[model samples]
Target chain A: MNILVCVKQVPDTNEIKIDPDTNTLIRDGVPSIVNPFDGYALEAAARIKDNAPDTKIVVLSMGPQQAETALCECLAIAADKAYLVTDRAFGGSDTLATSYILSKAIEKVEELENEKFDAVFCGKQAIDGDTAQVGPELAEHLGYPQVTCALEVKSEADGLHVYREAEDGKEVIGVKTPCLITFTKPSFDPRFPTIKRKIAARKAKIAQLTAAELTSIDPAHAGLKGSPTKVKRTYVPPRKEAGVVVKEETVEASAHKLFDLLSKAHVI
Target chain B: MPNYLKVTPEIIAELEKAAPGRVVTGADVNPDYSKDEMPIYGVRMPDVSIDAQSTEEVSAIMKICYEHDIPVTTRGAGTGLVGGCTPICGGVVICTMRMNRILSYDLENFAVTVQPGVLLQQLAEDALKHGCMYPPDPGEKMATLGGNVATNAGGMRAVKYGCTRDYVRAMTVVLPNGEITRFGGTVSKTSSGYSLVNLMIGSEGTLGIITELTLKLIPAPQATVSLMAPFEDLAACISVVPKFFMKHYQPQALEFFEKEILVSSEQYLGKQVFPRKIEGTDIGAYLLITFDGNSMEELDPIVESASEMLLEEGALDVLVADTPPKLKDIWAARSSFLEGIEEQTKLLDECDVVVPVNKIAPYVEFVDEAKKNYDFEVKYFGHAGDGNLHIYECSTDMDREEFKKQVREFLDSIYRKTMEFGGQISGEHGIGLGKVHYLEEAAGSVNMGLMLGIKKVFDPKLILNPGKVCMKL
Candidate 1:
């Protein structure tokens, strides 16, 4: 069965800076990193290829020119091939637009490979956005049954069985072939790219596609213009004020102060 | 270059047949599997993720990968420093998060046996419940024991207790060929031939994947006290470190921070740790010292004398604080020094340089001078008592490419100076992707060649975490 893994390049949250005067995200100089959640998704896809030797795992990502780094990283991890959807028109796309564009990319990838994707794997959500709407939305757009919060998956000839986490505990669900899944944390651990693979991935060619190249989508369906949510403002939360330490000489008094603080925070 | 190993559909069918309920394929693969704690990097979602509950499943998966020549990467809690946990190659990712059950805990032997996916914090808390402690605390509470062992992580307590390698008594490793082997035991010492356990300690999952670990433990101290000493001069503060060691006053932890670090830590923690604000004063650095003993009576006198000595040695004042919460706060600040540094700087790249105790002062001086010459800002702080100083370099003004280049040059200068003074490039943080060049420079071609040979011996197929430590394996 052919598998298609969707990945995304995002700004490093740790490196993200906020402008003091404007209270907006400062993107300048921030290192671009693979969305952490996507590692699990990639690992899942790789595992399938490992078990099913004939299974071809193709990676798909969306971003600017720098996003090639993310695709290169995918290749380094052992993905057979990688494609990047980079178009100026696709810039600033939100979950809805991003999912629509990804669906189109997957369709194009299938055409290029001369095969239909049996499954499309994606991270539950990107850390920067944390909207978590893309995976489910993509499934809806593609008319595929989706198993969100999927921790484990067992693929069979007829369909795929998944273990998904829920509010109470876990639920096992079965979906027909060509389904979609959004993985949750602690579901399956991601792997480290070996030294040999790193070299091969570095030399590997990442196929880049533009909006016009992938699909005949209207210009309004991509980029910032296509995104529904607009950022009115972004600001750093105010620094927490230091708490008053009840200068107590004994440990008991200090413990009481801590308990009081915890109570005030409604943690206790 | 050879896709010589053919993965037939029949073999895939066989694997699915063997693991009837374990295999996940297709779009059912989720995106959460893509990345780790660091979300800045883009996501390369996996095609499938297998939640192996037993060693049998892991072995079966590895066997399949070996037969298919498919790349396999083992993951723990995904709390790796470098992108070690990220499947940059997009192969099979065997996740150990579900295999978190504590197999055994022997109180009499002072050892604990646990699955590789057990969280370090959970293990520590469990050990505490048994009236013992695991000393290799690497700040991140969510970090797994396996990840710690993979990196051979050293934390604040490493000054006294050493790193994870020191406590790792044994490990159950899954070889590249899908063979399971146990190296070392619960014994305190080992003279066994070819210490594979030590070899696997910092291999970063490149050799064989660790499934379970037998970790040595120590009796937790009953009484503990913390003291913050503010020094008028940075050199004066660092100069007193050797004296403390020479005097035979063994401290559990001895950490040095610049005034900026201390102030930032205070702001981060939102509490007044020092008696007063030494910021903008002539005082340039502060040393936070901690001592733990079986009893308060035994610790009090040693702490008093140490305080008196610190004052005599140019310390402005040595302030003793209460135990438990206050002590935890001081340590939290010291432990969060890296985060504090990242919060203050634009771009942060750290080098964990280890030199002889005497060379530390010179190394600090050299790095400071390099900053002045290179026109950059660098911060110096770490396990001062252990001679492991983390020199953080950054460009407060330069662009991305120039910043990376300058940081590399600065690192080269400091690394060269460290080598001249007989030092290792990295003290703790293993060579993931960033420090391969420095590892080559420090270890030289001959030693590096031997390491590659060892890598070949362990992972003949080179399917394990490759391109790390010694690059281009």
Candidate 2:
């Protein structure tokens, strides 16, 4: 089985600092990390490759050249090949134009690798942009059955078995080959990159696709000029009011106070 | 043995007058003020608990305690594992936590002056903001710097950067007799006098109360990379530790943990950073190492050489965690080992013994052999770089006292082996109430007598943290 994973480099939100006066994110000191959901997507592909050693894992990303760091990390964590779709024309592309360009890049990658990917994996949403649209839109562009919020995936003889996270519980869904699946955070974290693989990845040349090389794509359908959606404004939400903090020095005392408050409120 | 005075209403009133609304009496005092982290040891609530807000308040409180001959136990965050902050003899518990303040920094002198109650974690974060690093990374981050100084707390970075004692530049201490005196200075070299500052450190608060301190700081390293080498068995994993020293590679921190503890930590943290199983074998032990240099370009070759050496020494594989999230994830698992053990175990007792680096494999094997005779489960891990092992004896089936009794016998044999390996009874954890007997047993009669003599010179009335370290009374 040949699997393709879509990965992205995102600023680690936990480390992101918010300016109190301006109410804007100070991304200066914030380090970039593999988008956690996308990491789960890659890990899901790696888990499949773990059981079936012959399953080739190819990871692709459409971002700036610095995003090669994320692609290199993907390469270190069991990916057989990594490709980055980088061009000035792809800048400021919304999820729609992004997905369209990704769909084109996926087809180009398939042709270049001489193999059609049996499955496509993506994070349900990028942490930086919680739109959660790219994977479904990409699947629409590719005309494949799609599954979202997948917690696990295993390849079967006839199709791919996916265990998806649901509101109440998990729902197992099966889809045929060449289907697109977006993953949520699973119980397991992505594996650490081995030193040997890290060194190997550092030296390996990453395949790059420029906007000009994508001859099948029209310039009219890329970048911010082609996107219809516009982000007007962004601001930090107002700080919530501080709630009552019961301090009794002991857990039991605190619990008793909380119980009393709950009884008074008739919340119990 | 000295007979000490107890806290009455008059004494409580006097303490309250010195610190104002900060003193609590009897059952009004929070129970946590009576003991440290290790509750299994002896516990005694102080008759009066006073939160001293300033050096003058501390001095005034000490004067009151001294005049009345009341036993005073100085406390920081009380995060100590050895009951160092426990008020074993009920009197006045002078909590310095209220005195917390980072006074100032002397960048030219490479020193930062802080109140004794400033927490280790607070100082670490603050120092980093100033482009400096406090290298003593103790497991208990919330522990007070005063408590750390009292215990001479050494930690993972001790192999490269020396312990808390090395960081001490100056301090204002209130002696047992209520004498407010300053010791040491912010100078790099101090050959001045009797080295009273060194004596106050590692005294476990038996001599005096630390109110303010000037600590030396080093410029922070620009880059750091952590690697884990998982081995099939512990012996193979631990034996490679000495190789780092022999090859002259200075790792910022080198830690070792058994697979079970790693699993527990992973479950506690809800994240698994280390591989439990590598290749076809279940990893028995892991060597968690870190390298810090001016830049990644400088550290790359060192990391490559170290990883190759680790693999050659029979590590199943070497995993790298360098990115911010990756580093945070790996360290969280490593740091939460104690919390994880406490969460799962019904009863727990630990020993922190530092042995010769080369003898770690043999000494740990001795601990393993000794575990067979006991009914309780034994868990061991350590800063392999320094040969300090944290061994825990835990049992859910045994009653607390029964476990204590068995642990007494268990520790007897282990202490003897530790001494045989030329090790100390306590490494980072001080000889608080829990390990007083072991320290006496290990130090022998002559050395013990000398320690008592030193304690007398500093605390003649036995009023400061009585029944700890060299103080039997």
User: What are the models' TM-scores?
Assistant: 0.60, 0.95
- Candidate 2 regions off by >4 Å? A20-22, A238-268
Using lDDT, give the best candidate's number.
2
lDDT by residue for model 2 over B1-473, one digit each (tens)?
A: 67887778888888878988888898999899989878888789999888888888888888888899898999999988888889988888988898889999998878999998899999999999898999999988988999999999998899899899999999999988888999999999978879999999999899899999999999999899999899999999999999998887899999998999988888877777777788878989999999998998899899999999999999999999988878888888999999889977988889999999999999989999999998899998999999999999888889888899999999999999999889988888989988988989899899999999999898888888889987775
Clashing pairs for model 2 are none
Tens-place lDDT per residue, model 1, A131-202, is 899999999989998989877677777688888889999999999978899987753345445334555666
Worst 10 residues of 2 chain B by lDDT: B267-276
Model 1 chain B, poorest ten-residue lDDT window?
Answer: B1-10
What global local distance difference test value does model 2 have? 0.91
Per-candidate local distance difference test: 0.77, 0.91
The superposed Cα distance between candidate 2 and the true structure at residue A135, in angstroms, equals 1.5
Q: Count the backbone clashes (under 3 Å) in each candidate.
A: 62, 0
Best by TM-score: 2
